[model samples]
Target: MLVVAGAMAETSLVAFRGWPSEALEFYEGLTADNSKTYWTAHLTVYETQVREPMTELLAALEPEFGPGKIFRPYRDVRFSKDKSPYKTHLGAWLEAGGYIQLSADGLAAGSGMYQMASDQLDRYRRAVADDRAGRELTTVIEAIEQARIHVQGHGSLKTVPRGYPKDHPRLDLLRHKGLVTWQEWAPAAWLGTAAARNRIVDFLRTSRPLRRWLDENVGPSTVQR
Candidate 1:
């Protein structure tokens, strides 16, 4: 939905009512028949029910979080063994640093560097090893957890990386290859309403401390993937 107040377009905002139930149904069908035939048959459903609402939501969120880019629905099967042609979910990344996804499982929101380059990993380990920065991170993670959001370490090592020993105080932090704060909500009635946006907004706001820690300490990876 759009509103035009006058000839001079003062504001052009697309209304985001949230994803309809059809969006989930589309994914459910795709999960069963993951082929071009299924996608081609349901292209209308994908564009209107899934993609449009997501674009509106991103637009609404951009005022505070900066621009958000939706991920391509097609899966990259070049290196993968499964070889699925399409992704099971729709996701977007906010430039300010956050993520949102919708799928058959429901909605998920997260913010962090999912994977780090070697240099970034090295910096992350060093920060975690330092008593002051490490303790601060621990506190941040604890608070986020208490809020019922999980802080995850992507590709965490079974043992603390190569150094810092078995008796290291911040062993758990050092083992993390990447850090992210994530929250998931199972499918429900609220998913088809604006409440969905509210939930993601809360998650992005709650992750501020964690984002600050990473930005101030680890920063971005210098090594190109």
Candidate 2:
């Protein structure tokens, strides 16, 4: 439900109440059908039960984490043979470089660069080469790992990249084309309660160190995709 206070305009805020089982059911059915007919039939369920809850959740996060944007459900099939009209997941990006996705599996959250451009990759490798910066990143990653979050490279080379010492102390970090911290929770009863929101909040906050390191070091990509 939306609450409107002042009447200057139609401004209102909706509190997140968590997603219902119908949201999951919708995706399950979509997965089997994957046609426009199924989507059209379930559009109302998507709006109220799935998309609205996501919007509310993002709004609740905005005060501290900045705004969030939900990804479009439509899938781009121009290059793929699958041609599924819709995506199996609903995902959002928090302005703080955090990501959240809901699907049949449940909730998944992550932070950091999923992939980097050539120039950005060069700088990232350089940062990982510096003793001070590399060690600091390792400490941060270890702490996150202790908390059960996993850090990984998007696509690593078979061996350490050339120019970097093959047996460098931080050699593992140097091979990454992208770096990120990620976690996934299987479907559970807790997903239908406020606890879901709390988990996302905790993950985003805990992953801040990794996010900061990437921003201060790797920064944004200057090269276009």
Candidate 3:
């Protein structure tokens, strides 16, 4: 189960890196490993129990976002020192909104669903504010905030766990990147339910249209060059 889930998670990472075929192959190999029969069995459980339905929801969302493009795996490290060889998962670009990460482990554990961190959301908002894109970031942010609120209000009972040191690297990086601000809502729990997942998919569909709109209204910014 973990192997399959991990493969699925890797698929998303690979997709994010723009290698769908490789991601698919990786998943297939992981499932075909006969030595780990129990893992395969567990994989079946998750696929039947979780993956299929999520795939359906994503399919229903296809028209709104158009076709998703896989990003290339090669890292353009001309300017960076830490150059890894390749990205390990597959990601789908949402036309109107943010992106989705798909991984086997993430899927199996239910955490690999949809993730758009506050900082990433904030970057999008800032881009819009800076006229880097056509659609307003505020609009998207408001919609996501509303969705989050809706999820929290009507969905699960999970709360943010405490006790992490204040100097945690992940938290620090998030703050440094301006992805999230330090506030009461800094570590809000994202509801993990089928309904919440559907809402996220819907949001991504709307968000994807930004690509076309941006190309027409704002053009690519200097940073893109």
Candidate 4:
């Protein structure tokens, strides 16, 4: 179970890094660990249900994303001031992948899993507004938004009052920091389950279609493809 969970987490990281094969190996090593703290600490109800299934899913996805080993522990703080010897958290990036940070105050504070980047965010907003599923860009955007909302709402907000002030620090941070915003299109119920992850993967697999649609509508001159 631990191995499966680790693999699921590593697969997400590896995909972000553009190295699918290495991501598999990364998960393998994590499973070998006797101490399961890493996996245990991160797994939520959704993660717990889908971890094993996602191992096979990631294996199938390996060919598309490429193969490479997990990144070694190293700090590259050339752009930051906090020169800690090691990264405080694990992270990944693929092109303009949005940033996600786990809050120190735990998930219930509603500050975890923020996605940022103004241009990309704008594109996402437009896609949701337009409901373009066949397009590669729209599919990815939808998957991300669905996954993010599920994780954020289910993993956090468990104790938050329904009527918590909109201007509260957490809500304000989500808005000002562009972490998350309310959407009229999204369903009211939470979609935090293994099934939700599978649905997300299915949506992401439409990358080719999305690319074609983006080419036709948005034009190649816009952001990097």
The most accurate candidate by TM-score is: 1
Candidate 4 Cα misplacement greater than 4 A, ranges = 1-60, 64-72, 92-203, 206-225
Model 2 deviation from the true structure expressed as Cα RMSD, one decimal place: 3.0
Which of 1 and 3 is the better model by lDDT? 1
Taking the tens digit of each residue's C-alpha lDDT, what string does model 3 give over 66-158?
444434534566788845433333344444334554443232111111323344334433343444341353354355455442111112113
**Worst-scoring 10-residue span by lDDT in model 4:** 100-109
Candidate 1 lDDT over 74-129, as tens digits, reads 99899999998999999999999999999999999999888889999999999998
lDDT for 150 (candidate 3) = 18
| Descending-TM-score candidate ranking | 1, 2, 3, 4
What is the per-residue lDDT of model 4 for residues 1-225, given as tens digits with 9 covering 90 to 100? 999999998866533211223233333444454233544543452133223333333444455533212223336768978554343323322121122111111111111224324454444334323434324433444664554432222222334234445444344222322322122112212232233333333433423333334334433223464
Model 3, TM vs. native: 0.33
Q: Can you tell me which runs of candidate 2 are displaced by over 4 Å?
A: 1-13
lDDT of 4: 0.34
Q: Could you tell me every candidate's TM-score relative to the true structure?
A: 0.94, 0.93, 0.33, 0.27
> Per-candidate RMSD vs. true structure?
2.5, 3.0, 15.3, 14.4
Winning candidate number (lDDT)? 1
Pairs clashing within candidate 1: none
Please give the ranking of all candidate structures by lDDT, highest first, separated by commas: 1, 2, 3, 4
Candidate 4 at residue 36, lDDT?
39
